[model samples]
Structure formats: structure tokens, C-alpha cells
Target: MYTLAIDLGGTKLSAALIGEKHDITQRRELPTPASASPQSLEYALAELTGHYQGKAHRVAVASTGIIANGVLTALNPDNLGGLNHFPLQACLEKLTGLPCLVLNDAQAAAWAEYCLLSDRFRHVTFITVSTGVGGGSVIAGRLLTGPHHFAGHIGHIQADPHGPICGCGRTGCVEAIASGRAIAAGAKHDLRGKDARAIFARAEQGHLQARQLIARSAEAIAQLSASLKALLDTECIVLGGSIGLAPGYREQVEELLTRLPPAFHLPVYPARYRHDAGLMGAALWCEYCAT
Candidate 1:
């Protein structure tokens, strides 16, 4: 079966046609609407799928929001403005006239990561530190979506009581400290207004302020990883997304993890699928469900 796999992120929308064996083809991408509203999302989806009218038999979506009973609502409203209560699955089904499945982007990515090492560990966690931090957990070989489909929303966990407020209205959320957005926002002096990538580049060149900003993000992630160890005892934590995979970033996080007690220092690995985790994960999940 051909699956029309789509990944809806904070900054972009991507779609691909996936063959039965999970090969991707005809992938396309577009910037997410500046003002993310229900109407804008509908328009975007239309434009994204316009060319593949008859190319797929089903649709699978990995999206940046809490997806419950086919409705999409943001845990952090600022990430997806005016997208609260959007009928995501219904809209996709209507748009494509195909069966549809929707899952949280992080959750889907975690499932993909889990599948890669299912023989090694029955418990796994995946964290993606991108524009905003996101995460998911798998325990006893089962993905935990929770009753509200919010089980893996780990980025909202508090990192500092006095830190800047998160888009989710929480103070000191891991997302506010550990995400790419946070890294960029934490810049000072000569690094002002630079994005996370630029800051990382500066850090490589031994820029003090840039290094400090990256270190701050890494520290938050290390703490978060330790907390996950205490809570889930996950065999390993897989880090993905732009910031998570950035050069030297994982090393920084690992070094900080070494500071904690031995029990909190779990093994950390980079995601295998990289940028395609969400798209491939959504496709894999839909296939599994259909079987």
C-alpha cells in the first residue's frame, strides 16, 4: 500500500509517498503558515497534496500538537497559533478521500526509534530538541499515548522555577531552556538575534557567550534525561531534531549526565532516521495499525 505520510511541524510542512516497504518518494516541503490557523492549515494541506491526487491509498500524519479523537490542539498555543481544536484527521481524510491516522510528531518519532532497537530494549524514550522540545516514551514494548494522548509531552517538565515562561504557559519548562528556540533566545552580547545554528557555529569558534548558551541547553537536557531515568528507567534515550543532532551537542549533554549519580546516567544515542523520523514513523504506525 502506498501511504501519504505527512509531518506537520512548527516551521514547516512536509509530505512524502511511502511504498509498502517504507521507501520514500516524491517528497515535498513548504514553510508552515506564519499565522497557523485552521483555514491556513487547510490551505497548506491542499497545496501539499495537490500533485499526488491518486498516488497513495492512505494518509498518516505526524503533527506538532496533542491529537485526541482526531482533533488537534496545542499544548503550547504559541507554536501553532489559532490551531486549537482543529479537525486534523477529518480534514486530511476529506482532502484526500483516504483512510487517515494521526499521531503526535514526537510520539511517532519515538515509535520509529523504538522499532530500530526493539530487540535490544523494551523501554525507550526519544527527545527532539528543535524549535521547541518534544519527547515520547515507550514502556514494555508499548507506545504510551496516555488517556489524553499527552503521555510523552516531556518538554513541559519544569527545568527551572525562575526561568522564562514557556509557550505552554508554564514557567521554566524544559522547552524554555533546552530547545533551539531557547538556545537562540538565550544569546547575549555579540550573539544577539542569531539563530541556534549560528550560535552553534560561534560556539565551535570558541565564542564565550555562544558556548554558554549551548551549554545551558545541554545542561537542561542532561537534567531531563536524568529525570527520565528516575521516572521510567528507560534503557536508553534517543535524541533527534536539529538541535539534538547538532555537532558536539550530544557530547555536551552526555558530559553533564556524567555529573549526576551513576543511576541517572543512562545511555544516549542519536536518532537513526534524522529528519525523516516523523514522516517514516507516521507511515510505520499506520501500517502497523492496519495489520
Candidate 2:
């Protein structure tokens, strides 16, 4: 049976048809509705999935938010705006007329990376530094979704108590410092109002301010990686998302981590599935749950 896999991210909504072998087909994307009202999101989802009607047996969703009891709550209001306490799973099932499974996007990506690297390592962590910084962990070859489904929310972890306030109403969270949004938010002068991608492009052209901004993000990520190593002894870290996968981003993170103690330094790898990690991961997870 095929699966309709959806990745609902802060900036975009992507859907795909996944065959039994997990190959994605008929993939499509739409800009996530600027309005965060439930109706707006529902309408967007309808349009996104309309083309694949009657093409799948089950539905899988990986979304950017805290998913609890099939509901989605945006921890950072900046990233998801008014999309709070949304009934994601029920909405998908209602739209698709099929059984559905839902999970945090980073969590789903973690599962996908873990599945790819499980033979080599039993403990792995996946970090996505997109509009926000998010993470998921697999320990002893098992994904940890936590009792409250908030297991790998490493982004909200405090990075600097004296830094700027995060959208989650906290101060100096990794997300507040390392996220693509954060990078853009921190821009100033000539760099003001530029998105993370543009900022990175400027950095590549040797803009000093751009370089510093990216380095700041990379440093926050490196510190977060060390914190994970200390807490979970993760064998490796898998990095993805727009900022995380930028041309030299991984190398920059690795370089910063090297300055720390050896114990905090672990292998960092790029996400194998890249942009499709969440989609394939959600599909694979649904299949695994069925068995």
C-alpha cells in the first residue's frame, strides 16, 4: 500500500506519494498560509492534498511544532505565528479519509537518519536549523518521543540567559540564536531585513558582518551539540534544514566543536535524506507502527 506523506513546515507545506519501498512520487509544495488561523491551514492542506485523492492507503504527517495527543502547539510563536493548539491528525484524517500518524518534523527526521545509520550507531541525534532550531534523539536504537511528546526540543534549551528573548517566551534559547529566523532577526545595517539564505550568500562574498552572524549561529549550534553529547552520549549528530545544510555550515559547526574538549566532540554528518527526511521518515514510521 502507498502512503500520503506530508511535511508541514513553518514556510512551506510539502506532500508526496510514497510507494511501498518508500520512494517518493508526485511530490508537491505550497507556501504555508500566512494566516495561522485553523481555517487558513485547513484550506491550504485541502489544496495541497487535492491532487493525490484516492492514491494512498494511509497518511503520515511530520510537522514543525509540539505534537501532543494529535494536536499541534507552536512552542515558538515567531515561527508558527497563530497556529497554536491545532488538531493536526484529525484534520489530516478528515481531509484524506485515511488513518494517519503525526509527529514532530525534527523527530521524524531523526527517525529517518537513525534508520539510515542504525547499523553504524545506536545513539544518534538529528538537528534542523531552519526557521527554528529543532532536534530529535534516538537512544539504543529506539526513538524517544517522550511521555509528553516533547523529547528532543533542544532548541528551547537555554543558550544564554542574558541574550535576547525567544519566541517561546524564554531568553537566549538556541533557537533564538541559531535558527535561520534568529539569524535574520539579528541582522543590522546593510544586512538588515535579509533572510538567512541571503545573509549566507553575503557571507560567501566576504561580508564581515554576514560572516560573524553565521559564526554566531554556528557557535550556538556547536554548544548545543556539546550539551547533547554530555547528556545523551550521542554517537553522532545529523544536521539538516536550510541553514544546517548550507554550503559550509556543517563544516563551520564541526570547526567550532573542535575547540571544545574531546569528550564533547562527536562525528557530525549531513542528513542523508536532506529535504525529504521528514516525508520519508513519517511514511516509514507509519509502516513500522503497522508492523
Candidate 1 per-residue lDDT over residues 1-291, each given as its tens digit = 799999998788999999987899999999988887789989999999887899999999999899998888887666567888889999999999999999999999999999999989999999998888888999998889999999888999999999999888999999999888898888887888999999989889999888889899999999999999999999999999899999988888988999998989888899999889999999998988898
Clashing pairs in 1: none
Quantify all predictions' global Cα lDDT against the true fold.
0.91, 0.92
List candidate 1 stretches off by more than 4 Å. none
Per-candidate TM equals 0.95, 0.94
Clashes of each: 0, 0
* 145: Cα error in model 1, Å: 0.8
Could you say which candidate leads in TM-score? 1
Q: How much is 131 displaced in model 1, in angstroms?
A: 1.2
Q: Candidate 1: lDDT over CA atoms?
A: 0.91
Candidate 1 lDDT trough over 10 residues, lowest sum: 72-81
